[model samples]
Target: MKTPIIMIAMLSLSAPALAGGDMPVKTSTEVAYQDLNLATAQGQKKLSDRIDIAARRVCKLDNSITGTRIRDRDAERCYVAAKERANQQFAAVVEQHAKGG
Candidate 1:
């Protein structure tokens, strides 16, 4: 018998505004799916949905080392980086879940 696989996805950030700087804003979201069966389309879709939500959530707020000028690319960069990380993470774990490894 094989054990159920649990997927825990998380994103987080924190920054404190220094003197004469914008207030640092940071946010993180963690999503967990219990007994996820990535072998099925439904399971894969759910995981993808969770990752999208998490990416948007993590990049929704702007965070800067010095709270300097915030650019749109910053959010896009964050989103892309987060999505890549999620894909890598899920790639390994999802395979395990699918094959019951």
Candidate 2:
């Protein structure tokens, strides 16, 4: 039996793009929940927390000293989008598991 993994990613305009440059960056991280039982609310909550942390890291919103005033807003946007995407992936994984996949 293989363990399930969730992928979290942020693909945004990036700091350079916010600074009037035409470049973008993509950052990604993985959350492994093989030890978690997604069928329970507690397990789901733990996975959600992990997703939040991963999203912050992917969007560079985890460190206060690494962003500027203008970039702060964009980072927030990136974090929201990244978390949404991660949630979608999580849902899919859960559904697949329920189907015995």
Q: What is the C-alpha local distance difference test score of each model?
A: 0.63, 0.82
Give the per-residue lDDT digits (tens) of candidate 1, residues 15-90: 3344446655555556565655678889888988887877876786344536566655656767887788777777
TM-score of 1: 0.61
Please give each candidate's TM-score: 0.61, 0.78
**lDDT at 31, model 2:** 94
List, residue by residue over 1-101, the lDDT tens digit for candidate 2. Answer: 65588888877885667698666767788999988888888888999999998888888885675455444777789898888888998998778777877
lDDT of 1: 0.63
After TM-score superposition, the amount by which residue 3's alpha carbon in candidate 2 deviates from its true location, in angstroms, is 5.8
Residue 11, candidate 2: C-alpha displacement in angstroms? 1.9
Error of 2 at 89 (Å): 0.7
lDDT of 2 at 59: 86
Question: Which residue pairs clash within candidate 1?
Answer: none
Cα RMSD, each candidate? 6.3, 3.2
Q: What is the lDDT of residue 13 in candidate 1?
A: 32
